[model samples]
Target: MKAVSLVPSLTEAVAVTLPGVLAGATDWCTHPADLDVTRIGGTKNPKLDRILALAPDLVIANEEENRAADLDALRAAGCEVLVTEVRSVPQAFAELARVLAACGAPGRPRWLAQAEAAWAALPEPPARRTAVVPVWRRPWMVLGRDTFAGDVLARLGIDHVHAGHLERYPRVPLDELRAAAPDLVVLPDEPYRFTAEDGPEAFPALPCALVSGRHLTWYGPSLAEAPRVLGEALRAARR
Candidate 1:
């Protein structure tokens, strides 16, 4: 079964689990480091021509990372596109299972089981702490309610100060975010590339955690290690 995966995490999931099934993937699908598939394009603006040229039997995409018009175009062109909606851990697992099964993956993949176990092993967080997590700068957008990353942080005992906002990814003024009096600032290294010197200075009064964006934001094979990896980073920077 030939497949074209637009989401990086799902690309890895399909490539690593099914092997030889992916005929094309987005440029951002960097996992399986040695992956040698046709480069279709980016997640938001995929090269529809190239994807169609690949003649993929299935195309995997995400509701959040991809554009609706593009998926509509693919469907209009008579291509079967699998659109995944992953907003939480359990939902991610279910979506993965559904996609894999739909694509004829041989039984349950080992990584899927490992990922489930990784999160299940974590004991309930003792006491939750309020945090401001900025995903981008220049305009300053944050993770709000119903985000997968927010739930991951919640599992690690960190609550979002912007969870009540109207937008899932809201752009708040920097001053207003600081005024919220968050206990810490959790910075991920992607979607904005926040580093120690650059991000920590914004909140001199609060402890800052520099986390891996893949572990904190992505939903796939990384789930197997995200819990331990993100938890350690949060704990190390706890004030």
Candidate 2:
């Protein structure tokens, strides 16, 4: 089946699990290093005309990663769209299965099984620590309540300082963030490219852990490696 995937993580999942089925994907779908699919612009602003031109049998989208108006436009053009809502590890797997099945992908993906086993075998973290994770810088938005990243961090024994905030992602001033006095500050590479020289300097008094955005925020095969990958980063942060 020909399909177009708008979400970067889901795009990689489909491309790796089923191959050739992906006719097009957003420019941000960077996994499967050798991927040569048609580029359909960014997740937030996909080239609707280009996607419609593909005439895919199925279109994979995420409730948060894509815009409602774009999905509606595709549906209005007679394309069968499979919108997925992945808020946690379990939900991600369930939605992946549902989307793949709906797209008629043959065979059970080995990576899916491996990811499940990875999360299942994860040992409970020794202790919990309070952290503030920033996703962007200019506006200073952070991970808040009901976020997949928050759940992952919680499982890894890090509690977000703003998880109880009304906004899922809220913009907090640097002064207020420092005032919160998180035990540590977690930085990811995307939505804002936080690096050793860049991010850690801001929280001079607090320890900082720089982690991969995919490992921290994405829910796909990366899940299989995240626990270990992120654990190392978090453990390496210095006071």
Candidate 3:
């Protein structure tokens, strides 16, 4: 099976879920190596002919990433397409399981049970909130309530100050950020790179830290490392 990924998260998801589910049964490939992603947004200027030529039995797309028109064409060509919309960590896991099941992988409940056990072992919440996590900029966005990032922060005992008010990945105003007054502002390296110098210029009054976007945001197998890293950040903020 050939998988065409326009987005990085989808790419990562396919990488983690497909092999385990397929049980290495199908040889798979992806296009646009080093697909210059500026933010969480997916592929631009995809090489369609290459993907079409692969003649995949299954084409997985994200409801947020893939173009509806493009998916339609693939379906019309007789490929079975499964589009997943992963808004939170649970949804991501469920979608992964769904894809795995569709690939004819057996014993999904066992895998999910193991994953749940790992998730259950993470840190508890703190008495106080610490930081705000912004995954994207330009329009100035944040990982808001109930998102993968929010869940990570919650696990780390760090409060997402805007969790109650904002939607997932919302474009928050600079003034609102100032008003929220988090102890530290976290700038992520992936999706968008935000530096300390950039922080002073963007919000002169706030302290900032450059964090690993992948660790804090990725919801798949990569999540194993997130709690430890985020726990460290939580400890640092307290110091």
Candidate 4:
């Protein structure tokens, strides 16, 4: 079954689970490092013409990562689109299974089962800490209510300061974020490429945990090691 994945996590999942099924993918689908598919474009702005030319039997996407108009256009052109919504860890697992099944996998991939076992094996965190997670800077947008990242953090015993915010990703002023006085500031290295030299400076008073965006945000094979990888980064920042 030929498939085109617009989401990076989905692309990796498909590539790893059912090799050579991907006919096209967005430029940002960088996992597997050796993926050789038609580079459609970015997740937000995929090249519809290029994707259409591939004539994939299935196109994988996410409700949050993909634009509605683009999905609509693909459907208008008779392409079957499998859009997934993963707001929590449980939802991510379920969606991954569904997407793989739709791609004609005989059964759940070993990686998916391993990822589930990894999360299930994690012990409850001893204590909870309040944190502010920034996905982007410049305008300073943060993870707010009902985000997959927020859910992931919660499982790691980190409570988002903006969990009660009305918007999912609110653009709060830097001053306001500082004023919130969170116990820690978590920065992932994507969507904005936050680094030790870059993001930590903004939260000089608070410990900033610079983390891998793939482990912190992406919901595929990375989920298997996210608990361990993110826990180490958070612990290091506290120390």
Please report the candidate that would top lDDT against the real structure.
4
> Roughly what TM-score does model 1 have, to 2 decimal places?
0.98
Model 4 weakest 10-residue run by lDDT: 230-239
Writing each residue's lDDT as its tens digit, candidate 1 over 116-204 gives 99888899887889999999999998999899999999989999999888899999998998999898899999889999877888888
Candidate 1 — which residues are off by over 4 angstroms? Answer: none
- What lDDT does candidate 4 reach at residue 161? 97
Cα deviation of 46, candidate 1, in Å? 0.6
Q: lDDT of candidate 3?
A: 0.61
Model 2 lDDT tens row, 1-239: 89999998888888888879999998988898899999999999999999999999999999999999999999999998988888788888898788777767675588888888888888887778999999998888999889899989888889989999999999999989989999899999987999999888888899999999999888777888888999999988757
Candidate 2 backbone collisions, by pair: none
C-alpha lDDT (0 to 100) for residue 145 of candidate 2: 88
TM-score of each candidate? Answer: 0.98, 0.97, 0.74, 0.98
Give the distance in Å from residue 75's predicted Cα in candidate 1 to where it truly belongs. 0.6
- Which residue pairs overlap in candidate 3's backbone? 6-43
Superposed by TM-score, candidate 2 places the C-alpha of residue 43 at a distance from the truth, in angstroms, of 0.5
Tens-digit per-residue lDDT, 1-239, candidate 3: 54445445545555555542211111112212333222222343344555566565666667765688877876787767788877666676788777666655565545455556667776456475667777776777887766667766666666777777557678987777878878877777766867666554676676666677766765555555566675675566432
Q: Give the per-residue lDDT of model 4 (tens digit) for 1-239.
A: 99999999999999999998999999999999999999999999999999999999999999999999999999999999999999999999999999999999999888899899988887888888999999998889999999999999999999999999999999999999999999899999998999888988988899899899999899998988899999999888783
| Steric clashes per prediction | 0, 0, 1, 0
